[model samples]
Target: MSRVRVHNFAVSIDGFATGEGQSLDAPFGHAGTRLHEWFFGTRTFQQQVLGKPDGSTGADDAIARTWNDGIGAEIMGRNKFGPQRGPWEDHDWNGWWGPNPPFHTPAFILTHHPRPSVEMEGGTTFHFIDATPQEALRQAREAAGDLDVRIGGGPTTVRAFLAEDLVDHLHIVVVPIVLGRGERLWDGLEGLDQRFQVESVTTPSGVTHMTYTRP
Candidate 1:
């Protein structure tokens, strides 16, 4: 069976995946961009994010390399896909990833509203599913074939999956920073007793790399 994993997902010292007031200008919210400095400076990130190849190999490279774990398909929430709340007004916006998004594999987006699959540059196909997370996961797994189904999040989506105990492995990059108040990764998820034992931990640069497997 294929594993459902979250790779290189960054979180603040204060337990915020994204700061408050997320907008087009600030997707991670105010001061949230600083949390990803470790990734932004890495060679892997420079190539993917800035479309440039000017970064050194070191701790950053090692951590950034883990972001792409041969994922065959991606699943994310509508909010993470975009800020267009309620229902999608139209197909005018595909996502915040621009014309050439990172996830080249098929991506399944959980949404209440329906929309046709968005075919973008770099072989990224966004399929909007109106069903629950389990349904979306099933589709993503089928689309993934032999590779793993990656859960890309905006906190809530991950929480839903975590609550349901659907995820198998999780990788988190804890950055040394604190956003006093923002979208927390663990908010409203106190009752779920699904405990994940630590698989391994790597300290690359200032970021703490940790991996957990549901056992």
Candidate 2:
């Protein structure tokens, strides 16, 4: 069966995946790019996101490079797509990733207000739908075919899937920061460790990468 996986997901030491006060100007809220500083210098991020020729190729880069491997589709919360709430006041707001999104596959956006599917460059198509985690995974798995479906997240969505035991593999990067307030990734997920065989590795970047794989 195709696996449901999450990769390069960054969380603060306190478990907050993203800070509060999200808006057009502040995509990650007050946290800004602090959560992702470890990833920014990776060769994978440099080539994939920044289109740069040179980047660090160490332990961090080694783990970050697997983010796109065998990913046929992605499921992200509406917040990860953009900061808009309620009815999408603007249809012109495609996404934060310009025309050529990095996913290069069908990307499903979980939302209360469903909108028309937007096709972008690089074979990335955004489909917005209102459904439970199971329903959304069904659609994503179908679109994913034989390849794995990636759960691209914004804490709430990831927590929902985790609670349901739908995720097969989870890679969480624990950045050493303390965000006093934000959307937490581990809320209501007590005893989550029992579900997976866990292992951790601390890279020289001072971030700990934890992998949870279902046994």
My TM-score estimates for the predictions, one after another, are 0.91, 0.98
Task: Give a tens-digit lDDT track for model 1, residues 100-160.
Answer: 9988899888888978898999989999988777898889999999999989997888878
Best by TM-score: 2
Q: All models: lDDT?
A: 0.82, 0.94
| Backbone clash count, each prediction separately | 0, 0
Candidate 2, residue 104: lDDT = 95
List model 2 lDDT by residue over 62-175, tens digit each. 999998999999999999999999998879988888888889999999999999999999899999999999999999999999999999998999999999999999999999
How much is the lDDT of residue 10 in candidate 2? 96
Looking at candidate 2, the ten consecutive residues that score lowest on lDDT are 89-98
